[model samples]
Target: MMRAADLPGVIPVFPLPGALLLPRARLPLHLFEPRYLAMLDDVLKTPHRLIGMVQPDPNPRAAQEDAPPPLHSIGCAGRVTQFSETEDGRYMITLAGISRFRVTEEVGGFCPYRRVKPSWEGFDRDLARSEKDTGFKRESFLDLLSRYFQAKSLDTDWETLKEADDEMLINSLSMLLSFDPEEKQALLEAPSLSTRRETLVTLIEYALRGGDDHGLLQ
Candidate 1:
């Protein structure tokens, strides 16, 4: 058992450009960049393993990036469980979700990745395990999602989607969908699974209507 204050919440974080990790789920990452490879080594050298996952604000026009993109306020802390180094000097790793964290402060570190002090006060255990069945509407919801994916020419496995647990289904789709930054932030900040589900349903409905708007995915 780890206490909030003793857990070193103010630690280095690597921002993944297009991934979202929900509590109790796992995220596999391929790390090739020098900065992130160093970050992985540093985290592996410690016992309290945790890092944040966030998407970079898309900038297709930038000729050269001056620095890493600004991260969103809300992110889930993931524990490094499995890691391997490739012959080409890349890291293949898996992160198991721990909890959602709110960034309190950012600090410059030895590595290029950003560090954050998280507010872990009042973190609830029940909220993390509260994955419930979606009941009758689940099939219909999935059907709508399939249609939307086909129209957009997105690749997804309907069979795997059906077998995925609640967190996997919700978080995976949320990360892949073409939701705007504001909406993505809202889903990241949503307090619980049910709330995230509600937001997802609304977003799916809006998308099915052929609207490319911010509110659809937020």
Candidate 2:
């Protein structure tokens, strides 16, 4: 029952280096570290129960020792749709992607996890559940994906790939693949579903052709 307006202007961000969560896709996260455990607790208290998934600075050189690395400006906020606690004091949670956000600024807080003001501009379409990309050539895209997987000796359930809708197929691959953080960011910031698909194709092809030692797992 949450609307776009129901989302908060400021949200807690989990600055994971390569994690990507696209709109309407679900990302599974294991929470063990103390700060994140605290973050989940506070998030659950909110009606939206959302968390922002972001990447650290793409340049490793920019990070100093022990201090938090500067975060990339664009990130996706997802509502916590599932949660479970283990006997070992760990947590398992699933974030259901809601919208992509721009980090306007970091909010100073007493809380241990970082908080930021998120702007949801230019992402109204993400609020809609079904986004169509008529230009998607499933047969051809799958052909390229098959090559990439084969080159990397990776295995996937082909039937599942065939069954998912276009957005699910593309977004899941973009989030789950081990492309470098920069490539992941490109996919996250893609203006639309079709654009994200194209970026993914380029990354996979570049990897297959040995583009860089680590240009982008990615």
Candidate 3:
């Protein structure tokens, strides 16, 4: 319901590792932590009702045992589209992803939740529902996916996966797969649908070969 121009310069952030929310996808979150519960309450009072879904930066150099881990620079902002309060005082909510943003800087505030100044310059196109991945060849990709899933001892409906469009098939897999945090970040930061698909293929190929995390960046 919020327009692109209405997005704020500074927004609240939730830095949970391994959670990937791509544009046009919905991420369901169960909020029990006091800070995040407060974050949900505060955002619901706003017109935009959005929060940045970012991952904790996994690089050892960016972290210290005594302090909170640094957040990755890039993340997607999602608007809360559904909400319900549980009897236990927790919140169950669904976020409909709007666009990706880069963390320009962390804002110091008294609010319990983290906030960051977001730069939404390069991701305006994310407002659209989907994009064409001209290079996507469905049949072969599914074959590779079958092999990877079998190796991981995972089961999925081949028909369901095959029926998804280019963007949905790629983004859903990118979000749902059990890839490491760094790889999930890479998928979230991919410049286009084609790039994400290629990265996904490369990842699955590596996982089939016993998962060389070091070589994924190469």
Q: Pick the candidate with the highest TM-score.
A: 3
- lDDT per residue (tens digit) for residues 18-120 in model 3: 8999999888999999999999889989989999999998788888788667999999999999999999999889999899999998998688989999999
List model 2 lDDT by residue over 139-208, tens digit each: 9989999998898899999999999999999999999888778888999999999989888888888887
Ranking by lDDT: 3, 2, 1
lDDT of 1: 0.72
The true-versus-predicted C-alpha distance at residue 131 of model 3, in Å, is: 0.7
User: Model 2, which residues run further than 4 Å from truth?
Assistant: 60-67, 216-218
Q: What is the Å distance of residue 200 in model 2 from its true position?
A: 0.7
Question: Candidate 2, after superposition: displacement of residue 71 in Å?
Answer: 0.8
Question: Which portions of model 3 miss their true places by more than 4 Å?
Answer: 63-67, 212-215
Better of 1 and 3 by lDDT: 3
Backbone clashes in model 2: 6
lDDT of each: 0.72, 0.89, 0.90
Task: Output the worst ten-in-a-row residue range by lDDT, candidate 2.
Answer: 209-218
The per-candidate count of clashes, in order, stands at 1, 6, 0
**Whose TM-score is higher: candidate 1's or candidate 2's?**
2
Determine which window of 10 residues in candidate 3 has minimal summed lDDT.
Answer: 209-218
Which pairs clash in the backbone of model 3? Answer: none
